[model samples]
Target: MVMETIEKVIVNLGASDIDSRLEELLIDGILYAFQEQIMNDDANVMLNEFGIVVNALGQRVKPYLPHICGTIK
Candidate 1:
């Protein structure tokens, strides 16, 4: 399912969006981990970084989509 979604996103968005989408995917995993509240400072830091990157990606992509899109939404 993930691969199929990736294919669809790739087809809809240009090459530049791939990096943002990839980061978005990774951030989802991190956010899940954080939401589950798995203990560990290192894990928290990693998740925080993922959130930061995801935010930046969203800032970049929001102008294009300008609506609900990507893993964050």
Candidate 2:
């Protein structure tokens, strides 16, 4: 499901002329991967590391994600 969303977002970004959309999809992919890793017991260590990285990266990407995702519209 997450991959699908990423693929769709990437496709949309490629088809559209929007830099924000590209940024949004890139962020979403990072978030989705983090979520998936955190949900698995075997990935607990990775999850912790990713949490810090995502938090730092997310701050930079959060602003444009909603517009590209269309979740608010």
Predicted model with the maximum TM-score? 1
TM-score list, all predictions: 0.34, 0.32
In terms of lDDT, the best-performing candidate is: 2
Give one digit per residue, the lDDT tens place, for model 1 in 9-67.
Answer: 54466336456566556545554644555456555464445444445455564443422
Give the count of colliding residue pairs in each prediction. 0, 0
| Candidate 2, poorest ten consecutive residues by summed lDDT | 47-56
lDDT (CA) per prediction: 0.48, 0.48
Off by over 4 Å in 2: 1-18, 38-73
lDDT score at residue 58, model 2, on the 0-100 scale: 49
lDDT of 2 by residue, 19-62 (tens): 56655665565555654553555355544443443344445555
Return the clash pairs for model 1, or none: none
19: Cα error in model 1, Å: 5.1
